[model samples]
Target chain A: MKTRIPVAVAFLSGFLMIVAFFGSGEWLSMLTNEALRYMTIVAGFSLLLGVVSITQVSWGVVRKRGEDWPYKIILLIALAAMTGFGVLQGITGGTVFEWLFDKIQKPMMATMFSVLAFYIASAAYRAFRARTVEASILLVTAIIVMIGRVPMGQYIYEDLPSVANWIMMFPNVAVQRGIIIGAALGAASMSLRIILGIERTYMGRG
Target chain B: MANQGNKGFFTRLQNVDRRVLFVLIFASVIVPLFFPLKLPVPVTPETREFFEAVEAIPDSSIVMLPFDFWPSTLAETEPMAVVGLRHLFRKNCYVVGLSNVGMGGPSIADRLLDSIGGEFGKTYGIDYVNLGYKANYQAVMLGMGERIEDIFPTDHRGTPLSEIPLMRRVPNYDSVSFIFVVSDNVAVDYWVGLVNSRFGVPMGAGVTAVMAPKSLSFVQANQLVGLMGGMKGCAEYENLLGYPARATRGMDSQSIIHLLIVLFIVMGNVGYFAAKRKAKVEG
Candidate 1:
């Protein structure tokens, strides 16, 4: 009975959305918009659920003095402080929430992302070997692109940038289109399966 | 003795410590920043198309700018957002800003709009309005197709859209002349697939360099009127605008890093081939 009810709800909603896509009527459009609104509301509630889940998990760790419990405590404190400030003073500029975000979070995130450059450079040097004809072709292409996309590339050769553009425009687009088409078809089929109740994994274990 | 020394050198090159490479990369990035190269940045066709698209928009036309990136990608995406807003305002276009990204996307857009809007002496609510972040971007996007106010009843600061003069004129996707999506993720796909394809609104995108290759197909299909791919793309846009900012300044560092990586790759390959030849000789 539990499974049947949820499955029925899914099928009804999915079918309505499909019909709304094809049909042309004010009532149908209104119904679809209302459904989308409800979906967004439900998604918003999920954020609250996430907060609750994290708090519970972190509290449990702190209570038990688990490994890295201190970090968990810090996380909880940070979370609570930010949430409190956001609720009390709002998240706009000149607020504590915005101040913390700008001063602490933004630079940390940027720094973490910047670290990837070093790893990418090291990986390229170690892994990019011309052991075979395919590898050689890839290596040559990489060199051309590396030279062509920047100002230095133009200095090295005026036409290097043009060659890089051709590679990106032609070979890259051809492969990307093929991938996009295949992925779209797969997604459509999967959606149909879910709507038809053939995909029950989302319903959780029996 | 010469052959022995050659073998040692090749082996060392093949097994250079990763820490050494890290230091080199760090130095490459930092040194260029301290000593600016002011290299000549060539504008790409994609960036030119993007610039021309905004330029072609009639004066006072309404445009939607979606900030769909997080702080992690601010380096690549922020310049795009800044220059895009600058260009839009330069044309005297009414701007409606929003975000599909949940984490800090709204805040980023709000800050950019405030700073850039201040530059143009533009008034809030009259010249621009931030619709802010919403959850379930798929639903938020499709709902906006019918009525934006339906999805976002209020501005980012919780003021009702009814009070915003800009919002009063913009009702739905039909009212938006163009959408310039600044993203570092797959949200661009949703904008292209769900919004542009469905509503027929012409769109352009500024995506991270890593995502550029994948986004090229959309540009090819005319799904995106123009595209800005990473720092280089941003630099190109800045150059076209005759405003060389962070992106232009950072290009020198980027160029040095790229050359350094290429040099390392070449050295590694030379070492590999040398080792192979030595093995053959010994055998």
Candidate 2:
């Protein structure tokens, strides 16, 4: 019955969504919105399941006094602090929570992102070469683009801008076109699998 | 005859070290950047088309800006976002901001919008409302298409979207001049397939250069109105705004870095051929 209900919901919801596009009625729109609302509710349940699994793993590792036990304790402390503040703010609409969100959370997000700057250089420094034909082409193109992109580079050398422009407008466009075609083919295959019910993996294993 | 050896091309290919390649690629990117090179740009007909479309909208259009890119691509995307919102505000466009991803987005978006929109005397909630994070990506897109209030019952605060003066009478996409996506990993195709086709509204994308190549098809198919690519696109838009912003500054670093990479590539190829000739002579 549970399986039947889902399969039925899937078939009906999927069909109606397509209809909602064509039908343009308030009832159909509301139905579409309700499906989204219900999906969010289900996602909440899924999240709860995830939180439980994560807590259990952390607790288990801490019990064993694993090498990373201190980090696990830190995680628990942060988890409690965030959850407490989140619930409290939701209940009271307080600014203390907003303060914590702005001061602490935003900085943390920025710091994580800033780490990528270092990593991009480190990765690029190791990869760009001209040992092979393809590698040579990429190296040349990358150079042209890097030079072409910078104002100072153009100032130092007059022709750099023209070269950069050529690389991006011509070769860059060609490569981008290839990616678009490849991605289109992929999106089609995945959508087809879902429509045919062959991609039941999205629903999880029985 | 030297090429006839059993340990030929494939042998050399198999033993290449990625680290050395990294250094060459590094040099290839950086040298040109320091050298100062500015290429002539002929704005593509499609990008021009998008700019005209935005211009065609009424003086005080209600526009939806979706902050979909995370902090990962923030460096590349933020310029377009800041500039686009600036232009929107300049035109007296009512802003409705939403994030299809994380909770962190609204605060950053809200603060940036307030600072920029403040210049044009735009107020929060009335002129611009940050709808905050909506869970379930595809579903949210569909929900917002019909009734945004249903998807977001309240503004980021406890206030309802429908209760807001600007949102009170607006009916779906008709009221939304366009949905502008300043995104990195979220491709233009997703916008076209998920949002544009779903809602039948105009969509625009500001994408990173690496991702720009893949996005041309949406432009080709007329699914997207405007396609802004990377820091250069940001610089061009900055020029359009009559202001030099982060993208303009970043262009210095970007240009130099690209040159450094190219030089390294040439050096590596030169070194490789020289090494091959030396080995042949020794043999």
Candidate 3:
């Protein structure tokens, strides 16, 4: 009864959304619009779910004195402090929140992102060996794209940028379109299966 | 010590400490910044198209600039956002700034608009307004097509959208002449699908370098009227704007890093081949 009722609701909602998209009925528009608003509100609450999950995980780590437990404690503290300040004074809460974000979060994000350069360089050096004919082709293509994408490539060879643009415009676009189309078809099929009650994975039985 | 003959130079090269590689990459990126290469930034057609598209917007036409990236991508996309905002403000276009990514985005937009708007002698709530962050990108986007105020009742600072002077003139996609989403992720696709295709609003993208290749099809199909790809794209736009900024300064470092990575790959392959030959000889 539980599964059946949820499936029926999903089907009805999905069917109405389709109608709202295709049909011109004013009620259909209102129904879909309200549904969208509901979905947004639901999504907003899901963020709270994320916060709760993080808190639970962090608390468990600290309570157990797990590896790097101090970091976990710090994480919980920062999270609570940020949320408290944000709720009390809002994002524009001036000095404290702004200072925390700019001084701590912003720099941390930047540092993490910056470390990618070193890692990418290391990974490339270790992995980009031309072991096979296919790998050789890939290596050459990658080098060409790298050169072509930057200004130095133009300095080195006037036609390099054009060649790079051609590669991106033709071969890259062809592949990207294929992936997009495949994903869209897959998503459509999955949506159809869900609406028809053939896909009950979301109900935790699959 | 006896097996040292088998440990050829190539094998040794293959075992180079990773720390050394890191240092090389770091130096390659950092040193070039101090010593500017001043290489010519050959503008791509896509970037040129982006600039021309923004330039062609008739004066006082509204533009929707959606900030859709966090600080993780601030390095790549922020410059584009800065230059894009500058271009719009320079054109005297009425701009509406919003963020769908969360608090980070709206704050970034607020700062960008405040810094850039002042130079253009633009006033908040009049020439430009920041609608701030809203949840559910699709819902917000679709709702905006129907009525923007329905989705964003207030600006980031809690000011009523109705009270904003610019909001009176621009209510939805119909009023906006151009929409550019500066994103680190697939939010550009949402803008393309929801806003542009459905509402017929012309759209552009300022995306991270990693995302540039994926967006080529949209540009080719004219679904995205223009694309500014990463920091390079920003440098091109800055050149067009005649205000060389961070993106321009960083290009030298970017160029050197690319070359360093390429050189690393080539060197690794050389070592690989040498190791293979050494193994055959030993056998």
Candidate 4:
């Protein structure tokens, strides 16, 4: 009953919203808004669940004597700091609480992305070998573009830029559009299953 | 093994070493940027078709623009958003912007909206209103179709939606001419499913290059009104909007990266086939 209840609600709510689009009823909007709030509450609870699960794992790591366990402690500490700061901010709308979000959170995300620069470069070195005709063309094109973007490619060859330009404008655009359209159709099918209550994986098991 | 039998040039070319292809692609991409390859990019009927949708809508027609990409995708999306927004503003359209990605999305949108909207004397709530990131994309989409304000109870500025003149008159998606989904993730799919399929709203999206091929399928099915894909899409958009901005620059960067990938692929394949030929002859 508990599992079926959520599924039923998802199905009915999906139908109501679909109906709302065609009709001039004011009631559907209110019902949809209520559903949005309900979903938000459920999403919020996931944060608590995540925190509790992390704490339990860290406690286990502390209990067990293992090398590199200090990292687990660090993870738990950071998690606690973020959770505490967030809760305090919510309780008392103050500037200091906002500071953690601005200073710590924002920088962490930027730094994480910057770290990818090294990873991508490493991936390029290992994977960018010219082992075939296609690889050679790719390596050459990549070199041209890489060089062209910087001061080097034009310094070496005059026509590399124009050649690079044609590839991106025509071939790349055609390929990308094809892929996105295919993926969207798949998404439509999946969402339809959810609406029809055929996809019940999202519903919690008894 | 190299794919044998009756194969066309393009199909045979597809089997080349990925790296070699990457290099060619890279050179093909980067050279244009440093050298400023001002090659003419023909604005396709699709882009013009999409531009018209937003352009034809009368000025002050409320539009919902969702930014569903982050900084990584900023390389692809920001330009599309900027170009589309500029065109909208040129038409004197009022935008109701929101983000479904995360806090970062709204943050980027906030800065961009401020800069772009400022150019047009666009006042918040008066010209545009930004609602910060909201979870439950499906529910938000549902709420938007019925009543946009109810779903976004508070504007980014913490003002109630009822107080906002735009929200009061135009309560839902039915009022908006179109929805622009600038996405690097699966967020666009959610929009298509919830809004386009359910409500028949005209939907357009900008996505990354890697995901562009999949997007074509949507275009084929007419599920999408139009699309701007990756750096190239940005480049075309730059040409469309007459900015020649980041997308143009990144197109160069992207072309270089693609060339590098292609070069490596070609090398791998050539080496493999050569080795195979040698073994067969030796035996």
Highest lDDT against the true fold, candidate: 1
Which residues of candidate 1, in runs, are more than 4 Å off? B1-7
Worst 10 residues of 4 chain B by lDDT: B7-16
What's the TM for model 4? Answer: 0.71
The best-first sequence of candidates by TM-score reads: 1, 3, 2, 4
Better of 1 and 2 by lDDT: 1
User: How close to the true structure is residue B200 of candidate 1, measured as C-alpha lDDT?
Assistant: 92
RMSD of each: 2.2, 5.8, 1.9, 8.1
TM-score of chain B of each: 0.96, 0.83, 0.96, 0.83
- Give DockQ: model 4: 0.18
* Docking class of predicted structure 2: acceptable
Residue B242, model 1: Cα distance from true site in angstroms: 1.5
In model 2 chain B, the worst 10-residue window by lDDT is B36-45
Cα lDDT of model 4 by residue, A1-206, tens digit: 87677778788877875666566655765665677777766766776687789899887887794566899888878877766765555411234544555566666776675455444643664455566788777767666545443323444576665555455545655776666568768977887888887887787442
Task: Provide interface RMSD per model, one decimal.
Answer: 1.0, 5.2, 1.3, 7.7
Error of 2 at B224 (Å): 1.9
Candidate 3 structure lDDT: 0.86
Arrange candidates by DockQ, descending.
1, 3, 2, 4
Runs in model 3 deviating more than 4 A are A93-95, B1-6
Shift in Å, residue B137, candidate 2? 2.1
lDDT, candidate 3, at A194: 94
State each model's CA lDDT, in order: 0.91, 0.69, 0.86, 0.67
DockQ of 3: 0.72
- Report the Cα lDDT for candidate 1: 0.91
